[model samples]
Target: MTTRSSPLPARLKSLLLLSCFLGGIGLMHAENWPRFRGPSGQGLSTEKRLPLHWSATSNVVWKVAIPGEGWSSPIVWGKRVFVTTVTDQSTRCRVLCLDRDSGELIWDRTVFEIVPLRKESKNSYATPTPVTDGKRVYAVFGDGSMAALDFKGGVVWTNREISFYSRHGLGASPVLHDGLLIMPFDGSNRVLKAGIWPNTSDEERLGWQIPWDKAFIVAVDARTGRRIWTASRGKSRIAHVTPNIHGTGRKAELISPAGDVIQGFDLRTGERLWTAYSQGEGVTPSFAMGEGLVFTASGFEKTTIRTLRLGGRGDVTSTHVAWEQRRGVPSQPSLLYLAPHLHSVTDGGVAHCYQAASGEVIYAERVGGNYSASPVAGAGHIYFLSENGETVVIRQGAEFSVVARNAIQEKTQASMAVSNGRLFIRTAGNLYCIGSKH
Candidate 1:
């Protein structure tokens, strides 16, 4: 006798399809590091089995010498790794793609070229990291030139609407959200007869020490590179902060910070939603949001860690600030808020942990290195990379307990990227992939 089987119920079939769709999403998240600090623009990785111990030779799956100079971090999408560099005497801004597993150059394309502007000694002509949406890679050069390229190294489009000029150059990387590419050009005045280095006089320090009104934030369509909208920051000093998105859906806001101010804008229209006054110039650290609170460091002058409550319209400086702590403020590295505790490391290498809710200090200990790269967390540990190529790993908690210290003994300024259980560290001249070969 032949037996017949009944088909699944309609509701059961719907549920099965949803499960497969969500599983595909989770797999995508585990395999890609598509932007500056990973998929979120905040240095947090979900990949497990990341290498905890690596050196110049040990635990290194592959190492390739990159051409030219760029402090921009490497970004990964699937089997490809992307990074930007400026070669030919800082006149040619180029993008390079490499094989993620084999460390071989897949393609190299020059996005644009320009007469490089005078930047800070530590800054580079290609300091802004590129962002990828799995199909195309978007990069912004120091001169405010932006371009989008396909996976095969063909240029799709380029935009040069803004001629960017910053005493510190372009350090803020562009961020991609909901088919829009957002970038901030918080720069100084175009003409300053006092030259590159400002003097003590306020006249000579027009844009460096004092704020200017030329600063603006822009958003462009990711696919066509067409200008969508531009929001003006009336008067603000130069900054190198990459913006991050907060909340979701219609209520979503872009949290962007420049010197002397931090503001939120509607993600779709670039409408200024709120503003908070922060002091000092040349701000570099980006915002860290969690538990409906935003954490950022005040740049230069008197540095401090300021925490603000989310949601408030117009100037919320007086109404939304929850607390301000002047200790352990980082001038370069971005703040890392890991659940109940907020973690920060100063440029001088002193690490501090604080209660995220009350802003109370839990512990402050010296880690011993000058840091330029921001801290990243994964596999139950926080990795802080220093300018001198030392990584101090500490367990995630209120206590100041260090897990391990790994060193490659090379000069490193770019933040590390984690993907598929490997750490991509960009030193001065080479990119090292750290993971077990097995």
Candidate 2:
């Protein structure tokens, strides 16, 4: 006769359920700040208890000096931190990996070397931030050179098919989706002479001021670095805006913005799906998307915040535009969309909060300092890092309220990264990991 097993004890069952419930909480808070603007690529963080007040000395878990020069922000994966820099007079491109906990250097490897391209004094040769898939780190330099390195500093693959040229240099980072690494080459055909600020005439600024058909977005196989497809922007000028994916699965769209055009492309096949004319050149701020709407800043010329409703075909300039705001559009920093509220700080130090659905300005105030690093949100606080390395922290609400103003008193241009309840800040000379000591 077969014997029947006894049921688990009531106490044991209760213990098991409680253990699972706690495990769920741990998983929820264990998100990585993987890319340029964290995992979402839109400067949003879900981890709580992030450091609210940190200076050069206080609350700093660890600090280390980074070699070379780069404006590329630190990207975190698991226990490793990855960042790229160009040394040897911006010719030697190097990628550095550090331990996430104690801020120790794990490995530093030079991926490749290239002749330095012309860039603005404020921009670096390694301006584009690196992206990782938890397996390998992918980086792109100013000359359209891409490299992938494994966690152990092993070079995986490199691609240098496109000869990228831009008057202001490349600043847009690559995004990884479905085993493909996609990057936009919205560069101009003309390269400005060294130390030249303004062009002599309109004829000398064909690619920068006038639209060109050679600008394209290319996708490569993540594993092999083989070209997957190239999507042309038709006729568009230069822009530094990075592309973000909208939706998921087969219906997803790659939302790409150039100087004068914001277009949607089929993520899988690289086909242009829709377009919206945004007149401007040298567009820097990456767009933000939420609630079935895409928000972008029309760069340079007539700087304005334009919101477009999703799901449109061909030219959606007139049909899909939901609202437009002209008061406080940021030219450098990207937009932060937090539910019903949108937050942005202009390069001139003016911060504004707006209603996400209506384009109504809730508050317009000056927090101080010139801002280039994009603002990051966590623990219901928005942290806006300025060029002078001062972070103006504000609470997320209808009324503009300052929470804390923290300063490291250094030169900083790269955006901040958050992960595991800690903030990774990259200044001109050092990388600081900020967290509570307790």
Candidate 3:
């Protein structure tokens, strides 16, 4: 009789160790907004006691003018806060680092100037939020210039290899996984006119002399800013969604939205793992991970939301789909999954709660305004920011219940950041730090 021995492959064992390594360290900088949707990319802040109410004139700890125009949210690390902005002529790109407590501008560095300007009315030049790893801060502009600066605002390294179209501007934020800083290049290859974005492909889909909108993700060394890997995302148009890291039993993959597909790539080498064919095009929604599923939403054309399961080899569309939801998914705003319940506000202001596991609607009610910014979850409450400058707090559960409604005097389309037990909200005019500070 022959005896058989069973063992795991060396590659599989290595992947297991990688997963363990990522899990051991904390994802978010507890007192920092390192990426788009806060730490862990779920929009939930582990803050102990965030303020429940605040206004333009009351409960405001400090207010600071943001300089030029860019709707990017603020990210803070240690004592420094960072945000990106562009000049009024849309030529010069800059990043400002401020003192976290005093709101003092520590360093304002001009990154670059656009040679030939390109911009859409709806998109600004510096819409992508910067990412920091406590040591250095990274920012990318609409012109495809990526730069890194030390905590003291000294230039570390800059890359001007890629050239991106300036239309609808670059809104995708950068993220850090392991020691690599990842950024997305998603936009039209050529200049897009105002009336060309709608239902016509003749004038809208013309190829550019340089294919900047090839739909790809690039990873760079966090410390040195060297190009580590570049993964192509096929031929897709513009996407304003930021990428997030997802955990599997095997390894953590960078989950990103490209056109009508949600893809997963190897975190270290940018190897394409898998891509799920999302039914909708022009995907602007980011991924939310929880309950063993990755939720993705689309913006234009066929609007729908799909929940995908993690860990699969090639196109795992059939094997990994957990559930799908079609009602009230936001085009621009990201969704929040709070175990057993998923909450999101549609572009039309319909606040919804769905059973995350089953994709069944628990409640869909109107909250009364448009929402472009993603909500922040903290202290057992969900804070929804509307375009009309209203912050509506609701209890997080299956049933819908409003906790409080706080309205700022100014209109804001930017998201809120919670760090170091304080809520930092970026409005159209100023950055307000809301907390007791006592």
Candidate 4:
């Protein structure tokens, strides 16, 4: 009798990995953290059972030490999780992929070499979160270098056609839609000349911000990195808001918040469709889309929440603006748009709930500790990640009630990612996966 040996262990493992990469292992159409915030480009996810409480020791799935510094949140697709970090002491922009099941380092690929720019004490060189559409991942750095990589860390393309340097470094993450990679280039030469960005005592004269004339939104082919179109923001100041893809069918629009003005771009051709005067500078909060309205927090100065009607042309500041509220608007954290109520947490730790359409303040409560991460909602609860790595879970409703306080006791600035009932938190030194069973 002839006996046949089973396939080798290594070959079986490889085949299994390939199958998972091709959407095996019960991985359906749902994406975990494919983009900056999560699927739908909002902080909210459809995850039903994220961990309610977890300390550094409790409910700890795995903790992996990350090299260098990065404020970008971890993104996931199928069985893999990808995060961008600066290696070689912030001199190289690199992408690290980890196996979602075991937290094993699958691969590490350095995309580009970048000189350190004068960033704020809180900002990092690898601040922009990498986004993926399952088959490939896209990572961009503050130096305006971008690259595309396959599932196995093979580099597919690199595009350096757009060069950018911000005095506060780059915080605007790229968004993908309609086969285009959209990036916001907002920096201030005035701030660079004044040496105003936090007084970093770099001996290399670390501040270099070009004039506002060069600041605009650029669209490149997501698969090929080919330039598609460029739209000038026109005298807009520095902003860090990410674009929100809203509307449906032929009326789809890319609503982006530019400092001093907010505008909508055509998703297909990068055409300037509509414009509004946001009347602010350093706008950081990403625009929230819901109920045919676009809501935004006009950054540090002239801070307020502006809600505008979806479709408008030219200057729609007065014509299409539904309401403007100045109550507990956050400068850094974006709001959670859950139909009737818009939830938000300020950098100073005050949480507020507002009526979505009319801009009416429902309730304002102080949850404590500074927050830079935006609010993400799942399983009928909203989560707010503070700068000190304290995740305050609150029941979402008309009245704000604290559900639980989970403290990890680490420094975290990146927003949290939720998917498949798991919460991914990225701190200054490590990446922790909660709700994972070892």
Candidate 5:
């Protein structure tokens, strides 16, 4: 006869199990600002009441000087904030960890000094933003060197996989999923001029064909820097843009913007899931994902915006695409959707509103100045920061209405990060945190 122990109260057992599950889910969302546009790479913050207006002298909690020259945005986990900056020489790569509340520099580490690398005039060595998993922060340099640092500023591992030429440098920020750090390498080895009579030799016309420069995404273990898997993109230049993970009923798909195509890969196995061809190159913008559809705006000769449904196999180019919008799409900044409508500003500063579900144009208005930073949305308002130090705050709706056109004294090319009911903008000269006191 087996003597079984009496079970605890049924209600108490169920309550304890539910509490543990909820706690795990909460912790999962805590350490995740993971990519170019925050969680999910959507540029939408569920963080409520993020401050709208900020200036150098007003609503500033703290301001700290970031050394070096990098346009990458900041990522935060718990009380620690992480940002990458270039050293004074522009040849050394630096990563700084800051206290989120006090804006104090906790630890500063210079990781690499690039000796030989080719980058476009507009790009820099530290343009790629760092990604963190709460325990480790991963920084990728333009020379194809990626290093993972512990929370206490200790180096875990570093890997220099491939070396190639970047026409505009390394602007593609890394993204994290589970235990993997995903990075994209897209480079072209040739530069062509239109005229000069078309009689130039194939070598003169095309330059050195960099057969090694192919578009591919690699996923490495965040803890050990080991390559978990890599998916090749076959002779393409995919730069600047980051990847977004979308749900496809069965599993999550890692969606990325390769040159002239928006491709999806298996998040678990690094398998090619699907591809949607578009009329774009140098794809730098992140996608807005929701309601079973992913919206992407192409860059640099990207005249159209496309919406593709998630979860398709092979070449779902024809069957998965929902709709495409062709007017005033952005070439640099990423797109933002306020649920029912999509909002974006072109490089020349044309603010556009489109129906998110149907891809219909609602309104088009000029906002002025040139823009490269991804716009931030908060407090029912959309914020557009131009390259000329102009901040345009607009009401989020079908009608294109400007709420406030504010300006700063300095130039800003980096996107603003919102946290703890405050807005942090990193400009060319300084970093400003804006918010009102309680």
Candidate 6:
């Protein structure tokens, strides 16, 4: 006795579903350069036909003057771009939002009024790159402050949790996993709870034992700024290596490098799973992982490049280590892998190529200029950015061949960001967008 309603025709339903699926594919094509090295944190963008050759005068879509000092790179999301800058002699930490299409400065908000601490000559207050997840942007500074701002530049939350900052300042940026913000606080010199540094007019610090255990990796709620998990690096020396995921899929392991050790931990619980051997006191470079091997370069002293086999429990010091490259390793710039070979440009501009699995030296050649910005690879070419504004683009293969020697002729320390077939470079003087009518 009930009236029956007929379903839509099968062909019509299929057509409607196909329409929605294609719409989603269109949205996915709208990419966002989210983190330090784009989406994968490897400086490899899926964006094809990126502008290969660019100068201050050529392919310049828009150039805007940035009014501050920072080493953080620009991150783009949809139609907006985000970057952080610390001005007023490193006292003001600011978050800048710009139009991605026109490079117009839409909003600039000061996140914190910081008292800049003793930092290395090269490290600025706003060295850690801000990360965005379309809803909000996150920034961290040298003065031990991290702030989350909404997409429209409203301050959502701020945390000054670890005041014991080291001398080299904050450089490792926060990474987003699921619903949390992962930040690593690794400093060489630790400040006491009373804010007294080792030699900062406080002779009392000379007699007191400086806590080398102050360094740690922490995760906070992305929306609330509340601590979710923390793992202590009490046995670790100071390091600034940013944490990255190791495994594939939704459940991946987190790996963080310390002074003399690289530890793997559970991302959800922060429980230590394994620790690998990496020698040196200041482990600055982050790890590059793929194909069952995790590659890392130790800090200045010794500078040993290690390739460890991933997926193990407990101590992986000897069991998981695959190979080690002892010479011409980098301390500041991270490693890049292009198929069967791994590439690295040392801080002194020495370019190296090694076998990905065996660590066999393929070729060693010197490019030019002292390098701090990590090399980025694109369009079958590897880009090595130097501190003096020169970028050497080389062919990516077993043999080393320089493609072009391009420059903006301005000092810059940030790595280039590629998005939507355009290259965004932040220098000491200006922010430039490079494109070729794409």
Among the numbered candidates, top lDDT falls to 2
Cα lDDT tens digits for candidate 4, 1-438:
999988779988998889888865334443478988898888878865678989998998889998888999899998898999998879988999998867899999998997677777888888888899888999989778999999999999999887676757788899888778888887665233434443444422221221155577888898899888998776667778888788666787788887778888887777888788766777888878888888888866778899998778988988998899998888889888998899889889999999998989999999999999988988889999999999999998999999999999999999988766688899999999898582
Off by over 4 Å in 6: 1-30, 192-195, 199-211, 248-250
lDDT of 5 by residue, 45-155 (tens): 676565656666777888888887888888777778788887867878888988877889999988877753556666778788888777889999877789999988988
Candidate ranking under TM-score, highest first, comes to 2, 1, 6, 4, 3, 5
What would the TM-score be for candidate 4 when compared with the true structure?
A: 0.88
Candidate 4, residue 368: the lDDT equals: 97
| Model 1 CA RMSD to the hidden true structure, in angstroms | 4.4
TM-scores for all candidates: the values are 0.92, 0.94, 0.87, 0.88, 0.86, 0.90
List the lowest-lDDT window of 10 residues for candidate 2.
190-199
Residue-by-residue lDDT tens digits, candidate 2, 138-250: 99998999999999999999998877887788999999999999999998766435634445666347568889888999999999999999999999988999899999999
Poorest 10 consecutive residues by lDDT, candidate 3 = 204-213
Candidate 3 or 6, higher lDDT?
Answer: 6
Candidate 1 lDDT score at position 265: 95
Instruction: Give candidate 3's total backbone clashes.
Output: 0
Worst 10 residues of 5 by lDDT: 203-212
Clashing pairs in 3: none
- Please give the RMSD to the true structure for each candidate, in Å: 4.4, 4.3, 11.8, 8.0, 7.8, 6.5
Once fitted onto the true fold, the runs of candidate 4 whose alpha carbons sit more than 4 angstroms away are: 1-31, 190-211, 436-438
Root mean square deviation (Cα) for candidate 3 = 11.8
Candidate 2: which stretches are off by over 4 Å? 1-9, 12-29, 191-203
Error of 2 at 404 (Å): 0.9
Model 6: pairs clashing at backbone N, Cα or C within 3 Å = none
Candidates arranged by lDDT, highest first: 2, 1, 4, 6, 3, 5
The total of clashing pairs for model 2 equals 0
